[model samples]
Target: MRIYLVTPRNPESFWTYDRILPSLGKRCIFPNLSMPTVAGMTPRDHEIVLCDENVEEIDFDVEADIIGVTGYIVHKPRMLEIIAEFRRRGRFVVVGGPYASLCPEDLRGTCNVLFVDEAEETWPQFLADFARGAPQAEYRPAEKPDLTTSPTPRFDLLKVDQYHAMTIQFARGCPFNCEFCDIIVVYGRRPRVKGVPQVMAEIEECHRLGATQVFLVDDNFIGNKKLAKELLRTIATWSEAHGHPMYFNTEVSLNVAQDDELLELLRAARFTTIFIGIESPRKASLQETKKTQNMRGNLVDNVRKIQSYGIQVQAGMIVGFDADDESIFEEQLRFIQDARIPVSMTGMLQAMPKTPLHERMAKEGRLIAESVGDQFVFSNILPKAMSRIELYKGYRKLIAELYEFRNFRTRTLEFILNRGRQVGEGLAIRREELRLAARVLRDTVLSTSPRRAWFTLSLLGATLMKRPAAIADALAFAIVHKALYEYMQSLDHHLERVIGEIEAATETMTAAAVNA
Candidate 1:
């Protein structure tokens, strides 16, 4: 069968350097990991063509016996549109991925077959069943397959030139079950890791394919600390033998600070950055969400210790929580500043489908009377203590304050100053640092709005002339913040549409009631 595997285009968000990524010369961030994995799952004899719209355009007229698309919550609308288009052309459409697996009802009658959970254990069976003209309404894994059996992703199907970095998964699942997180629900609590040899082999393949940076897209890369350390040690040796061609990045728990040996291994392997989920600093909120990792010690100090090894930390922060009151916004912003975290992914708490929080909200009658599709565009569910409007307003205020060109620049400079000093750096090291610094300044200046040009100019002058050390620390901060600013702006537009729809629906309901 001629199969067309696709990663749908996200109409609401597009890769634009002018919006969020000023420092990156590349057009897009990363290829969609799931579609490629699904392609790998297909039988070898079947002819398959993969198209990731992030890297290339989709040819709607392409002939195929089957059309497969995968995505997460944010890309639901686009995924549905692709399925609808294929169905309109009278083609068999298979929908799967985190979103579809969690909310099968979203594609109820549109998709011919829905594959839930990991496809590694069930996709081959699905292929055989489909080829025999016995397609089932739903396909589910009887058990999560062992990681050792999973094959390397079909990276050759990707447009290597379009993405900033390549991705590889070393582990599946996370140990922590934070109330707002869907990782445990999807992948389970007991972490499953790929063998050390298997992981290195994948890294070697990425190197062969010209990937300079590899993102370990695991929910928690170090969920299995012993395995992670072993892998990093092996990767360090590989880097030594291969002339250090690629740098690594991944997400991990805050407890990474407790292990000096692990940090050293990561540094030796050229692990440049790590994303830590420091959800919130408020101990009450942390306990409420079951994220005890942040409550162990000084969260800011733990991050600073990681940064001391020259591994940059990108922290994730969420604003809405049951325990949080209106003051949470200021608290979160202050926490970001106090921690001196360069890049922060701040979003309002969203209760994704099939999660513990989602079920609890539904049970409490707190879930807004809206469809799953509506939840993706905006924060549909409200917190127990706060009104929907308050949450919306707080989120907007925090985003505007953080992304304000002047405030961002000033905070970045302060973070740099806080990073004491680096002694005994060679000319080569200094030159590379200077280049990164220059790129950050240029990106920040170009990406900000015209109204903030004055602040940008002032920052550029201070960074280049007055504070050389500050430039080094602020570079990564500016790159991520610029991207986030553009993303928030897009969200603002989306929120407006959602609000308009709500108002229209409310007015219609009121009129109908009056007439009755």
Candidate 2:
């Protein structure tokens, strides 16, 4: 049977960086790593082809016996559109991924079956049943599969030149039970990790494909400390032998600061960047969300300690928690600036389906809608401590202040002042990386001449003089900062109008009710 895999297009998310894609000449950061991976699990006899809609237009006219599609909550509408179109054409549609696994109701009748959960076992079973002419309407696995048995992802299916970084996964699940996160809910909190050889094989595959940067897209890279350290040791040895071509990065909890050996292992592994979820500075909010790991001790000191080890920390922050008050906006801004995090992706907290936060909001009758995955959009639940308007207003103020050109530059300067670690050896500046940094520098120069040009020039000179090898990454980080700033600016402008509309509509309803 002909099998065609489809990844839905990413919407205008705060992190989408659609505006900056042209600057880098890339279609997307990377094609959804899941589609190509699930494609690998399909039986070898069937003709398998995959298309990431972010890269190319989907050809609805293309003939296929079965069409496979994947998406998260944000891509629900697009996935439904694809399923409808394919079903109209008399082709069976199979839907899976995070969205389908957590919220199958979103596409109940649009497809023949909603394939929920991991595809490793389900895909082969579905193919066999299809071959026998008795396919089920849903494929839900009772247990997660062993990562060691997973196939090498079909990276060849991707257009390698179009992405900034190739994505790979070495592990699944997070050990922590943060109430707001769906990771532990979807995959258990035990943190199932791939064997060292399996991870090395995947990285080798990435190297073979000419990928210079690899993102180990684990929710928590250090979730399973023992295995993670073992993997890191293997990566360190293999990367050195391979001339350390691929600069790796991933997400891990803030408690990574507590482990000196793990930090050294990560540094030795040449992990250039890591995203830490410092959700909120409010201790009450952290406690409320059960993110005790972030509140273990002094948060700022933890961030500084991690940075001292040389891994660039990209913090994931959120506002609008039930325990948050008006003070939260300024507190978040102050913490971000103080922490010297060059890239802090702060957004309104949304109650995701199947997460504890969602269930709590539902129980309290505060859930207004399911989170559509829009970071800039309104929260899906009613704020317990503040009005929705107040939350939106404060959120707008927080991001606008934090991401402004002057504020962002000030934070970068602070990073330079306290910058302790140097880039790991053998991670050479590739032509592609340099070109992106150059383009970003040019853009910054064009927009920055009127103010702070001299300061930036001097800073760049110092950074280069002090850490020339790290300059490329520093500039690349500037590119991301620029994207986030631009996104925040646009989000502020649009959200203001949306807030006004919401208030006006509310006023109209109030007036109508009083008249009645």
Candidate 3:
């Protein structure tokens, strides 16, 4: 059998790091772990090829027995187009991943085979059936497969040099159920993780492939604390033994601040970054969205505590909610600045399919359209407190204020000053990272834009003076801020057009009602 695994292209957004990738000499941030893992699932006798559309163009004419496409909601439009192109070329097409798994009905007529939930068990079944000349239109597991037996991803298939980081998964599912989150719906709440040896092997594989930065890509790294500690301890030991060839990062709930031991294990394992969903500071919004974990403690203090352990906290914040009003935007902005989180990814609240929020919105007849996963530009649900136009305008204003040159610099500097010290191994910067840093510095120094040049140079000086050991990290933050500021600037025209259309439509309806 011949297989071609494809990951669709993502639109230019903060996560894409589109602007900075050029300076860093990378195609994308990282490859999605799904494709490589799926490649690993194929039989050894079969030929497998993998391509990330973000990094390379897809050849519709490729000679392959079957085409497998996977992506999140952000890539749905591109995924559909890719699948249609392949099927139009008379190739078998299969669709899966977060978007398909959450809303398979949306993909029903578009592809020959659709996979839902975990694919470890269903992928092999589909392969066997296809070989026998009879394949199911859809494959969904009756129960979640054991991750302990999951196969190591075929990282060899990926163009490692093109990516800035490598991706691996240590676990799936989250213990907490945030109403808008799709993880719990897809993976269940009982965190399932791979064996320690399996995880170490994946790490070793990544290291052997010249990957210095690896993302764990877990739904919540500490969802199961006991298991997570066990894994972290093993990782700490193995990383020390291997001279910390790869520094790790992952996502976790903010409740991790309460666990000092887990924080120690993470620092000991040389995990340099952790993304936490500090969705909102408003207690009402938190309760409305069922993200009570964030409300358990002082959000600002928790973030600082995490940073105190020398782990950079990249935050995820949302604005739209039933409990949010016009004032919520300022609240979010103030909270982000107060938290001193350098990379605060704020987006409009989206009612993703299969989540509790989506169901409630549907029941209330508030779902306006399917969410496209670009939170800055789109929101599917009609808010209870503000009109759609108002929501969009407020969100745009909030983003502008948050990423404004002065504010961005202040927060970034504060973070660096408070980022604390690295307590464990892996302190030395790798040769590749130094090269990236030099490139970043050179680009910023040569930049024609005054705001960008000042932002990087100013941050560079402060980091050099206060935390010289973190000069590379400071440069990385400056690059990300540059990407985000440029991305927002690119969206201005499109956003204004969308808002104008909505406002015009609203006025038309209002005038018609008055005339009647």
Q: Which number leads on TM-score?
A: 3
Sort order, TM-score high to low: 3, 2, 1
After superposing all C-alphas onto the true structure, candidate 3 shows an RMSD in angstroms of 1.5
The order of the candidates by lDDT, greatest first, is 3, 2, 1
Q: What does candidate 2's lDDT look like per residue over 379-411, in tens digits? A: 888898998889999998888888777787777
Task: List ranges where model 3 is wrong by over 4 Å.
Answer: 423-428
Return the lDDT, model 1, position 398.
79
lDDT of 1 by residue, 1-516 (tens): 888998876543423343543365555677778877887777778888998886678888899988898988777778878888888888888988888777778777888999888999778888888889998989888887799888888888777766778999999999888987888988999899999998888888888888878999999998999999999999989987876777799999999998999888888888878999898888998998889978988987888888777677788888778888889988888878767675677776777777887888888887774334333246657676776656766776776777766667766665565543332211134444466556766656665566544555665567767666445444555566556667767777766666666667768988999999
Q: What C-alpha lDDT, on a 0 to 100 scale, does residue 124 get in candidate 1?
A: 85
Off by over 4 Å in 2: 423-428, 446-459, 465-469, 512-516
Q: Distance (Å) between predicted and true CA of 430, model 1?
A: 14
Considering only N, C-alpha and C atoms within 3 Å, which residue pairs clash in candidate 1? Answer: 20-483
